[model samples]
Target: MKRRKFIKKSLIGGAAITMPFVLPSGRLFASSGNRMADHVVFVAFAGGVRQQESVLQRYLDDSQAYPSAGNIMYNILDGAPPTDKIVYGTTNYVNGDTPIPKMLSQTLQQQGTFFKEVNASVVGHYAGVNTLLTGNYMFTQGLRNKPLTPTIFEYLRRLTGEKATKTWFIGNGIGNSIPLLDYSTHSDYGAQYGANFLAPIVTFGNSGDKHLKNAKVYHPEEELDPMYKMKYFLDNVWYSQGSALPNIGNTEEEKLEIKQFVRDMFQKKDNGSIAFPPISDSGDLQTIGYACEVLKRFKPTLTVIYLSNVDGCHGNFSSYLRSLHRADHGVGHLWDFIQNQVPEMSGNTTMIVAPEHGRNDDPNGIKDANAFYGYDHSDSNSQRIFNMMVGPGIDSNLSIGNENNKVGDIVNIAPTIAEILGFKNDIVNTGLLASNQSFFDLI
Candidate 1:
């Protein structure tokens, strides 16, 4: 109930915003993917995040200081605590004001291999989520009439050798449905659709889905018992929507193939298995829990996890201590698990954590009449996001690069992953494809 109101009030007028941050032009990487980043593990705030709450920020006006992110040691597993505040940069937090800053230059500098300038033109949750997940984006009004493009999961399958069969979109606030890039019905899946462009097997959930713990204990060879059925009816609902549409394409064979694919997906809905909850837009606790589960049990070679609690707490601008603490803790756990629990995950994995976008915060919402608008990220493309990188092949402490004010826009992520996976796709999506070579040093 509160969330619906939140969305309604936060909705911006007109079309959704689209900002593309492309990589700097030049040959920076001598090579790609260091020893530690042999594999890829991506963690993101499913929803948009203001820089104030995360690792980096772009500053224009006065910013506030909350808590400093403990240096790497402070976050070390069971390491000695720092006696003083682990201040990386200065903050000037005031009561009732948005806790975020208009600019976070210091945070940007300290943020190892992070992007300083990134933007999310849209303010709505769905638009931001779509933009972040898929390189393609739609502005506020355009989104209502149009559809988004394929996401990382889809790209991973089509371009890279990686299969969507093992992929997961855990705890999706919105039920999993592949976004459609083809604008018109003719270009889109059309009326007779098989499997309807794309679909993931099972969505991992949180407390509601307790199957994770049990799955961990059970051997992989063991057959999932009687209760583990994935109701084909649910998947068919999606297929039915596709099938019921009029034949979209000019050709008959294509139409038949489309319908056939959708039917096959329905029949095989129960085939794959995962145990995390569908993530909630409200916060990040469940996301942390899910990441821990993946690290402990199902360590898919290519994975993407969403963390948004920081965004939530910051948006409210009350006491975000809990949100920051949780984000820091969650990040620590993931890193620790990679090194300790899943030793193989260390050098073999490349971890990328980036926020959807930045915000305009200073901790005191009541300070002005503009409190409501103060809670969100600005439209300025020069400064509105942050990115973090770490892994076997990466340098311990580093910044993104020094070519452009921005490293790349939201569109570059898929290609970055594809590069790490050693896959090459000549055709690309919106904006220029950001090269993955920048990841070499951070590995």
Candidate 2:
């Protein structure tokens, strides 16, 4: 066998042996329903966004007591860019003073329904994201523990019979228990129904380059026989101890495809062909680039991207502002890529963006180099957030709720996604969510 082909086969065979496990028996019946769209992309605009800085577009007016006020997130919100005291773009222009050019002709708020104000009950990162994915304010959820309830991935896969590859949880990094969110520990829906998880930066960065960029082709008889026997022996020993390995239940074909996709991504990176935003400086931007690649290659029925670079507000408010600005740019790029590059998902995908939680109304007294005060999340203002959706069957330029009248909750996102994908009834019937109402119901 050719060396490349042998390496591929060897990796597949080795994975099969080392990760041997049983697939969960999903629900006996599948839902028979019509989908509003063929795909759903959920962006967890997380890391404690503040309502004053974000939806209010207060810029420096509310946060720093500076009279200057304008929108810094022009791609998602329909507002003019901030005019003065700019520090949220590439330094190549003028000391990071010039904002990145908007990628979308029309803002997402103009193209979709925008919930100006939404409620998030949880303030911490882990609980906040857990609530977003599971649609429950799991106050008991620990920072180190997997979700206590079935995540949306499990709900979609088990109730609708979607394959593992058709769903994904692409996290920015493998920190703060992000990889665990792909699945939950729920009895009815667990590993078998989990989405494939990838922290692409870690997977494709220096660590991957060092460990996975090359593989020696091991001869089947001379090298593989002993490895297979050792794997089986270890599996038996582990199983005998009443423990079993967790698997996402990717079929051999799906595994091979994923492996090949990883290889292709590395090659693309080398050739400067990865579909990154024009300015890919931050970790969030790089993650978004990989996310675009995933969308083009898999065209998944459901894909969740988590970005948290804006969490820098804890100490460096200027950097936080820059991260928030770049996040908006990345989102604009992602939507533009789907519409113009990924034909399979173009006009057939519903994209939803919501922060897991909001930051405090008051600052923590820590100032940045720009003499800006840092903020944390722990007050009522932290409950404030916004949710936006754009796609077929959704109303255009419709603005709902406001600063005084909140129309939706963070928990509504999972069912909203389920509704878009035609599985809302199944998900709601489980009686697991805090709010059974989808965002459509609010309309």
TM-score of each: 0.54, 0.90
Q: Find the 10 residues in a row with the least total lDDT in model 1.
A: 192-201
Per-candidate alpha-carbon RMSD to the true structure: 17.7, 10.4
Flag regions of model 1 displaced more than 4 Å: 1-38, 52-112, 119-123, 140-147, 172-283, 313-315, 361-374, 381-383, 401-404, 426-443
Which candidate should be chosen as best, given lDDT against the real structure?
A: 2
lDDT of each residue in 26-87, candidate 1, tens digit only: 12222232223445777665444555334332221223332333222123111222223322
**Which structure among the candidates has the greatest TM-score?**
2
Rate residue 373 of model 2 by lDDT.
Answer: 97
Error of 2 at 61 (Å): 0.7
lDDT of every model, 2 decimals: 0.42, 0.91
Candidate 2 lDDT (Cα, 0 to 1): 0.91
lDDT of 2 by residue, 245-295 (tens): 788889857976888898888889899999999999999999999999999
